[model samples]
Target: MRRDDRENWRRVSRRRFIRLTGATLSLAPFIPLHASAAAKARIGVLKFGTVSWELDTITHHGFDRENGVELDITYFAGEDATNVAMLAGDLDIIVTDWLWVSRQRAAGEDITLIPYSSAVGAIMVKEASPIRAVTDLTGRKIGVAGGPIDKSWLLLQAFCQRDHGIDLAAQNDIVFGAPPLISEKAMQGELDAVLNFWHFCARLEARGFRRLIGTNDAAMALGAKGPVSALGYVFHEDWARANPQAIEGFARASAQAKKLLATSDAEWLRLAPIVKAEGTELEKLRDRYREGIPTRPVAEEEADAAKLYLVLAQVGGQRLVGQSPEMAPGTFWEGMPK
Candidate 1:
């Protein structure tokens, strides 16, 4: 997004939202584009992820209203659905990867990335399991979330190559599946180890799984100098230009929500009903939040994100995003409201 496009969005009053809803007063499922001139932009979110947590916070606390926009959040079951919705013009912004934006721009899709969430993943196993390290898993069946081309999985391969002198893809019986399956297989003893995303890694830990390698160490293993942001908000350049305030408000309110998460564990408990998360999951959530989320929205070390990109480009290959060595230029958006 351009600097000149970062105008202030007009905040929509609760009265206007009610009026727009016409007595039923619903907040989701059907937010009209011209509703109340509050700079509406539909946001598609995954059932899980940092944006889901933050967006839920923003809406429940009216942070979006304070920041000057009306957010209509649509929940998607998978990342592919979210990306597809963005391409179909059904969603204005969705939490995705810069890598995907690189691929889309290569296809002439006009997608651009803005910083969103960053956390480290892990290769975890049962506490009592004989698998004490990534190197020990030479013949083990490892469950990998997001599959072979997953950025984290690619990073794991990079780590193995640099540190262990072996090909992870060629060595283990890698099962590519969802995050939940990582826990399920690990618990069932069907998988000796599993590589899960940060949030899910926390859940696996809460369930008594031990980390063979954590995110920071995993980054080192993958050849990054430090922690980096792999996920972000993806947008259409044309839509972002036309409704600058909408884009700015989303990022601004999200920053506020990130700050809220950093400051209050009580606030974390408050989000359970909204995100439909509860119990032990809350503790796991706290673990991920405390150790995974950054003090600022952008990673403290900018070089970290670049090192991550290099690993993904070199290791992820054509399977991940179809772009290699060169990511699309101007993918990062610097138009957040001051």
Candidate 2:
């Protein structure tokens, strides 16, 4: 042991410590900046193929964390399961329609909704089929999503009754089934026409099927015309009130993501795998996204809702429309962050 040896050892130790500190500092920037500051929001998503791709956009592009929302996303089989989760307090937010929230509020649930999606479903007939107009559907074999209580089905009936002097539920031999199969059956010529969710309908249309009527068109035929985003992001009122900033953050992030998707084909192509979409289905999906994604929340009363009550009352009856001539105040929360 010598003094010089001890000095050399001290220098080595100091050099090792400095290198270790530098390495740690290099990794520090990777930590999510808003992980601590952002509020956590547990969101339920219904996996409707590419119909909910905007949600995928938010996640794929890191919009959630960027906008200060710590997202806890859970996917359900469909809207019904998501609704159950929302009612059971298992979720903070869900992708749903305003009608569901309004119905729950009518039944004394403390539920409210914000705009999320709109103009995303349609009725389709084979491209070569003879069904050219609403009047042409009589005596045809048709397929529909949901059932007699299905909103799209009921909307068709109401629209026909009001404008065409007919009832779709009665004029056609309507078979109720799942959405995916409806498209398949139509492609196979098993049905004359099908009322389906937007993405599937668009896919079919892209493959040479024709839309006899889109959901927005159905709304219009019922005298409720405009680009009303019927679908919404729903939350229990108390959860929304307690986490206003988080809610606003999430809303803004969603808006940013939606705009990104609508404007940038490259973004859509990048995120197409989220829905397992490829090839023509992928392009069709992009078209559907372009058709449905609203540039802004339909905030104007006329365009935002467009005699929305008639659609609700016709589809869901008293159980959904309730006694209110219009949506109860606060039922439709336009509380997005400015």
Candidate 3:
């Protein structure tokens, strides 16, 4: 062949090799190999509790890196504040209270429930106090972090009213307190009781505080057949739509984490360090996890709707506005791997 013809053949061969390489790469793990090659996104989370674990892991471990994407996370105090930040467009994705998703939707804000994990709150009181039963809470002053829209407090009241025929709001004074203040106030005996989630309640229990009730128990009492829950992941609607791959990537990582927790005691032991509460009270943390992490996301529409409406209605003195209490939208996704 002439020199010019040989050179033309080599150029064609190189172009074909490049095309085959691109096709081969595309057929591999789309996330683990592709997303990280793209761009990094931020995931916002609420810092108050153990519920932030999945996003926290994603943020720290490059939830994006495993899937080929980059992730950054910011933590906030409570769901209300987190929602405010989400609405202001400060977050790419977020994990927040599932109940707040509906509350935000009812108020005409658009957000979705990503439903990554599950947890329940417990009612804590000092062991030395005379409060041995939920009924004993009737006249005691109770402290909760968020005002009325908080699901646990509302569920507590519903369980009390529905099961025992006691009107909690009319019977006990419900005070909204900051997260850090609950332990101090409860220990000081200034507050008769407080509703707490995860290790905070565990801390109280470790400190000789008696738990008159757990949110899970209350959920069963309210006829929740499976896991009655106080916690899950919430994401902004627009943010999730634009960042679907990010959501999918993070969800895949979280499902893997859940499977790890479920199958391996070793993994649980490993996580025990990170999720465990610090201080001498740490034994309480072990006990709390031993009870089990539900990890099942609630349905967006049916299962969680009434719960949200009931809680929010009790808060605002309205029943989801124009919508009937019996019907509402489910905002969460299903089909995460077990």
Candidate 4:
């Protein structure tokens, strides 16, 4: 058989194996002792990185069980693919960066933000590098994993333009490549800086990279209050509309999970390994988990994330609010289910 055919067969076989043996996959340990059995709910999780904590909890903790749903998950590369899958109906829901939704809305794509997570991605530089601060980023090359239209890249650019008067679009050398390659290049001194989320940045810092700036720092610098800063969840509008009960069940589970995470730091820490199983060290995992996990259902953070996208839309020559001030502001996270 051809290579593509072989790969396709492998995928089919793998999924079939899961479907056949998933019942025996042993949910005994993951599910809470008190969880009640429920119906099945298949959800797609785009494997962006370490943000699987919420999903892990949903699947493992019997949240789905209690709510009459069995969570079936599909993981993908990043927000782009996840959003595409959502649009194509291959995925019913997706957890991705809020900016993806904003861009989708700007393009008239039918997606909705279900809930907001917290901010975490930050800029990393070698500790010995002469660039000590964000202001020093002038005239230096910066690497972002996602390309130009990425929300983080745009936000970083806005920060530079608004604060230092340096238009990154015009002056800075911003490169897009795989995070591993970027991290390796940054380590070899081939690049002055690289942008990374907490997981990778922690590894960089452990290897002696200094944090030049982050969304949190920029938020403080900009005096942002109730502004959205980073990642969140999205789902197909039609799917959400049609499967209101399923959606409500998922949301209810999420609220419970968020509540548990907020009140119990110890429990949250114990659950970190599930999210960080892809080789993140304990300390780094703890740090990344703590950065935003505790802030689930934080209204101010969600609002800030929506506004961040609106601002990016403005910068990209798109009006998020449709040129009506009252209509625009409310359009963002306006009809979101509480």
Which predicted model would earn the best TM-score? 2
* Alpha-carbon lDDT, every model: 0.76, 0.76, 0.64, 0.65
Off by over 4 Å in 2: 1-35, 48-52, 296-298, 301-306, 319-326
Ranking by lDDT: 2, 1, 4, 3
Candidate 2 lDDT tens digits, 214-280 = 7777776666546667677888778878997679888888888878877898886787667667788
Backbone clash pairs for candidate 3 read: 31-67, 35-68, 35-69, 36-68, 36-69, 96-234, 300-330, 300-331, 300-332, 301-330
Report the lDDT tens digits of candidate 1 across residue range 148-194.
Answer: 78777777787788888878888878888878877788888899888
Window of ten residues with lowest summed lDDT in model 2: 297-306
lDDT of 3 by residue, 163-272 (tens): 78888788888788766687778888889989876667877877788788887677666656555434455666665567666666666766556655455555444555
- Looking at model 4, residue 55 earns an lDDT score of 70
RMSD of each: 12.4, 5.1, 5.5, 13.4
Q: 112-159, model 4: which lDDT tens digit per residue?
A: 665545546688988788888777877788888766665566677788
